[model samples]
Structure formats: C-alpha cells, structure tokens
Target: MTSLVKVLNENTIYNSEKLSNFIKYLEEKYIIKDEVIFFNQLVNFSQNNSIPLHGWFKYREGYSHTLVREMITRFTIDTKKEFIVDPFCGAGTTLVEAAVNNLDSMGVDVNPMSVAVTNAKTNSYSKADIEEVKLLIEEIPSIDLDQTEIIDYEDIQQYFSEDNFRALLAIKEFVNNISKPSVKELFFSGFLSIIEDSSDRKRDGNGLKKSLSKVTSVIDFYCDKMKLLMADISESSFCNIGKGYFGSATQLDKYVHEFSEEINKKPGLIVFSPPYANSFDYFESYKMELRMGDFIPRLGVKGLSDLRRLAIRSFVSAAKDPIEVDEIIDLMAIEIEEAIPLKETYTGKKDSRTRKVPQMIRGYFHDMGKVLEKCGKVLESGHKCCIVVDQSSYLGKIVPTDLFLAYLGEQVGFNVKEIIICRKAKTSGQQLQKYPYLAESLRESIVVLEKK
Candidate 1:
C-alpha cells in the first residue's frame, strides 16, 4: 500500500489500485475538482506512450501538454460530441490530443510553417515510409555555392555552417522533388525544424534577441543542424500523428461551408490560442522558412504586401460589427503612434518605418471575429469553445482581449460562460514596471463560451 506519488516517483508500473490512489493524491494536492478519474487514466496512458502533438515542434512558448489534456477532459464531460476544431492550431497540439482521444478534429493556421509542422505531426504514417524518406534525405549530396550570390540580405548565416548549409540545401531540393503531398509535407516539416539549428542563430538563446546576427557561414551551420535533426527523427520514429493545412482561419469558413452539406453534425469543441495583441511578427520570426519555401518574394525583406493582404482579408471577413472594427483600428493607431519614438531612438533608419501594429491588430481581431462567427455557426448548440488568450499591455495601455472576445462571442450568438485565469511568467520588462499592480496582474485567461 505504497503512496501513489511514491510509486510514480519510483517508476513502478501502475495498476488500477495504484492509479486510483494517485487520483486521490492529485485531488488532495492540487485541488483538481473535476474529471479526476479521467485525468488519472490519461496520465497513466501518457506514461506508456508519447503525447502526440506535444512532440511535434519544440516552441519555448508552446502550451503544456498536461494543460491540454486537462482541457480535453473537461470538454468531454461538458459535451457529448466527436469532433473538435482549433482555428489557430499552432503546432497542432489540440488536434493531436483530440485524435489520441479518438475524436476527429480539424486545425487551421495562417502561417505556412506552422501548418507544415502540424500536418507532419498529425498525419498517420508507417515506419517504412519514414525510413524511406530518411534514406532519401541521407542520399542528398552536399554542394557548396558561393555564399555572396546565394545568400540574401538579412539572412542569418551564423545559424548554420557552410558544409551544413549544402547538406540542408540538398535535402531541401530532394524534399521539393517528392511527389506525394503527405510525404512532402512530412519532409518539409523536418526540414523547417532544422533550419534554425543549422544556421548560426543561437537556437538555445532567448528569442527576443537577434542571435543569428553573429553567424557568418550559412551552409556549414545548416549541415550541422540537419545532422542533429536527422538523429532526433531517427530515434523517435513512432509518435508523429496529425495532419496540417496551409490557409488562413478567415478563409476556412468557405472550406467548412462547402464540406458542411455532407455532414449534419457540428464540432463538439473548438479550442485555440490566437496571436496576442502584443504585436510580435510571426512572419519575421520564421522568415527563414518563408525564404526556403520561396513564399516570400525576396529574402531578408519583410513582406509588407503579404501582411497587408492578410490583414485586409481577415478584417473584411471577421468583423462582427462596426464597434469591433473601430476598437481594432483604435488599438492599431495607438501602436503606430508608440512606434514613432522607438524608431527615433534606434540607429537603423529602417526602424523608422511606419508601425504596422495598428493594421495588424485590426486585421487580427477582424479575422478572429469572423472565425468566431463561423465557429458559432458550425458548433452544435450547448457545445463549448475554449480559447486561451492573454491581455497584452503596450505603451502602458491594456488591451482587454477577454472583454473584447466576450463581446464578439455575444455578437456571434454565443454566451460567455466563464473566464478562467491562468497565471503566466512575467517578462523582465513587465517585472520592471513602476506600477506593482501592472507588474503582478494575470496575463492569460481561458475564455469559455457556449453556442446557444
């Protein structure tokens, strides 16, 4: 009759009795009020098998797999449905978990890189297929090209070595040659994951800095990175399990509408973590992938046109009302105004470009609103949609994301049921804020809405 925690700590095989004791222990220690029994079962299962989507791409800011499992458990108890949808499915965490639970699920993301990663993780693939791809990847011959002509401006060459870059380029060429869409996607994902590692960019460093600036030889950097990536893939060949799509959430409505006629039922749950109001450029962070994929027109240049087009599309389709649109505009304007002084302080003239924050925010919400409207339509009545979001404070003003989402949900004919606060680690800048309240306040909240 050893304690469950002790047994778990000792790495002993858990039986029914030991698992029950663990559930009781969790309830006593953490005050888990709902689905304790289910959670125990899930934890036991997780011990045996790697969590599906959680293993895909390792993002420093990625959501916890444990948290996702808990959310899924809660979702199952609240509704009796078979399908879940994550409109902003970063790395396909939700979809992978849903599939593991034996529920059909759909995930959508605007970032092509994220979509590629998601698709690779969720899609069912045989070990033979993976081995074949691995063999093909190894067969690629490394060829060195003159660094000056091939590498673009703003290219983070430090992230990869010359030899590694040639190896990576060879692999990229082979992946592009693959005929099957599914296999191509898997290869591309693995390629994308290694890009940062292969480059001179310090992959292990904090993301806030331009760590890639220090590296000089891109080819050798990429080669080293890919070799490591290939090793990881070779070791963990069994866990990948989800599919991904390259499209905007705003555009997904049309896709769903077309498919809806074939199916009478709506999704049981729709969960997502959309981009925050903080104005971090997702495109900028993964510019390397866009460069490799040839999605961006030119290397090292920010695609302002692409950004503007996406914003316009999202705004046009997602805005529920004039007020929501206005709110987005106002937020964007503030961000634009704030950027002026920041540009003035920086030595780079390029930093002085007009801040697109205003446009980006407006476009984000407008698209999100449209996505919510579509979700309201596709979600079955009484089913739940949970969004993990955070209020972002910029220039000493707080963006009330939770409040805004609640309002948007009401406009789309859903009732905001609850807002569960989840504490977040404060950034250093936030910690230095003069106002103690601002420094210590909750940043994230799970907004739960029900389609009526």
Candidate 2:
C-alpha cells in the first residue's frame, strides 16, 4: 500500500491507496448524483443566519429550518407522521419545526448547551409569557461581577473585557431570579444569544477567534434578542408537542422508552444532521455560555472530560480509550495512518491540530453506527430515517460519510431507500490549505434509509 507521493513543502512521502480503496469499496453503495436541489435545501449556516429564533444562537454546524420542513413534507403522509426523533438535534430544528407544524418530536444531544437551547427553542410561548419576561427584565437588578462568580476560568477570561463580563453578569443574575421554568429557560437562552456581542471571542465555524474590536452592551444585545424572540414567539403556536432531553445520542432509544407515553408509537421518521467528523467540538465552542450557565465542572452534563467522552469523536481526542467500531472502519483508519501518516501531513504546516484525525474519523461512523442500531430498535417497519451529512476528510483521505452510514444502516436491518444530492459543499480555505493534493470538495447529501 506504500507509494511515494508529493507533499506540499515537505519531502516526497509515502502515500497509501487505502483512502482510494476505501472510497472504491464505498462505491458499491455510493450512488452518483441524480439531480440537484436548491441552495436552501443544503444544510448550512447562511440559510439559518437571518431566520428568527433559529438564528438566536449560532450552533455553527446546525442546519436550516427549510431542510427540516422539506424532509417532513417528503417523508410524512398528509402531515400524519406520528413521531420524529433527532438523536443529534443541534438547535432543535427538527423538534422545533415539528412542533410548529403540530407534530410530535423528540430531540437528544450530548452537549448540555445545545440541549438547553433546543429545549427553550421548542418550548411553547404566549403573549403573557413574553410580557412576563419583559417585566422580569425591568425588575431584575445588576450585580457587581467582581463579587459574583459568573465565569471562573482564565482561558475563558481571555475572551471577555471587564465591562463585557460585568454586563453579562447582570443579565445572567436576572435570569437566575426568574421562578418560572419555561421563562427561565427562555431568558437563559436570550442571555446566551448575546454572548457573541459581549465577548471579543468570535465563533467561527471551526474555532473561536479573539477580536480586540469594540462590541455592543450586553443589555442592548439582550434587548435586541428579546425583541426578535418575542416576534418569533408571537407567530409560533403553543403546541406542547415537542420535547428535548439532555442525554447522549448513542442512547436515544433508551430515552424514547423512558420518556414515551403508552400511546406514543415508534417514530415514523428519525431525521437529524449529526455533527460532521470535522474537528469542531460544540463544548469547546460554547465554553463561555456553558460556564455562565454553570453546566460544566461538577454541575452540568458531566465534566469537560465526560462531555468529550459522550460526544461523537468529532475533534481532538482526550486520554480516553478509542471507541470500538467495525473492523473495516478500523482497518481503513489504520490504512489512513499508514498511507498519509498524520505527523507527515503537517511537517511544514502551521496548523497541526490533526494528530487524531484517524480516531475522529473512526469514532464518528462508529458512534453513528451504534446510533443507527438504537434508532433501528424504535423505528416501525417501513419507517424512514433521513440523515443530513457532509463528507469528512483527513489529510488527503476523504471519507464518504453518508455512503458509509448508509451501508451501516443496511447491516442493522434497513434498506437504502435513496441518497439525494442536496448541493456541493463549500470547501473552507483552511481545508484547501490543509490538503493541497485533494482536488475537489465533497457533496452534502441526505441518506434515506427504511426498515426492511
């Protein structure tokens, strides 16, 4: 498998056909493009950037509302789809949008911040509720952040100015005084919405960047957030139909059994966009928000270590053991390491944050395979699962993630219904810089599978 390949700015290195062979194997099930959908059908941040409550907080990898709506219409019969479960429901697009259309839905995620945001987004709000929040805003008092413990980490402190920190404290302290659970969650979400404005920490898709530029007041940002939130809520119906849980996606079926009423049937459609295998960790991205809410350390989700443990291997690995997956996947990972050699890929490169690309790649499909098995247990016969995902790559080795998941679905008693080409994904400049030999970007597709 060893063959000499030219590496940019580095010595001529050994490359393996492992990646090529892996893609070739996947070609057995990988359906070439049949047709193209509109740009809005693709899962992206742009489509969601201007949308109401959907735009509240940026879960950078979260898909747009139109994707969910389109999926719901296509899979359901006359809007009679009884249940939808999203194991990796970031921002609760599936659950929130489902409730808007008056459908039953459940959402799950390992990240506490994402779960809380989704829970608040899907919560039913009314005119009275909005008024209650506004009144609380006026009544709430600002506390001296010097005396209060809003954020305690030094790494996080690098992102906040003293004034920004104090202003954020006032808003969070206000949220703490609210007694209503629903209103509390809503206000807490509103508080989170303004974090980007309060801090110089600009959240790019893959990483956080520190900016020295001046930002707006926390109160002003929160006020703007509330106005848009109230507008979104005003048009939103109080369905009481959607529910979200703070749990791991790997155990989604367990949550289904524990939370479901006797009358609630198995899900008719299991639709979600799991985070890509790219090195984007939600827990790291929202550290400021999570620290403010006290959802980390001893209080929330688990600790930072445990959150990474529960999360799909999307980014850098901790000292934890590698997750067990299919032998083929493991072998491919081994071959990837042998072929490109992770260390060699970044010999002269400045950004060398990919020591564990093999594991993240293996761990992603590994956890997703388990997710499919768990989801398979709860889906009715003939029910469909629609997974929106983009292709994942490491070094020059691109993994056909959607196709691999489709094959894994077949192994767990589901037939590949079809793979729909949504749109060609926009390659990041970082990706281009990272893998110079790779010629093209991959496609983002919806892999449709049905229980046999």
lDDT tens per residue, model 1, 1-452: 12223433443222234333433343244321223344446445553124434654555445655556677887773223345677777777776666666555667776766777777766665666666666655554344243223345235444456665655666666677888776677667767866665565543322323344433554444444445445544454434233445666677665454434334334667788777665555665566666676667654345534643453232222223334474434544454556557545764555322344445456566767887888888777888888777765444333456656766787898887776555432434642463234444425666788999
Q: State TM-scores per candidate.
A: 0.69, 0.86
lDDT of each: 0.57, 0.72
- Identify the runs in model 2 with alpha carbons over 4 angstroms from their true place: 1-22, 28-33, 37-46, 77-81, 140-155, 298-302, 318-324, 341-352, 428-441
lDDT of 2 by residue, 328-407 (tens): 67765675566554446556553335556777677777778889998899887898999988876555555667778888
lDDT of 1: 0.57
Q: Kindly report which residue pairs in candidate 2 clash with one another.
A: none
> In terms of TM-score, how similar is model 2 to the real structure?
0.86
RMSD of each: 12.1, 5.0
Give the RMSD in angstroms, all C-alphas superposed, for model 1.
12.1
| Candidate 2 all-Cα RMSD | 5.0
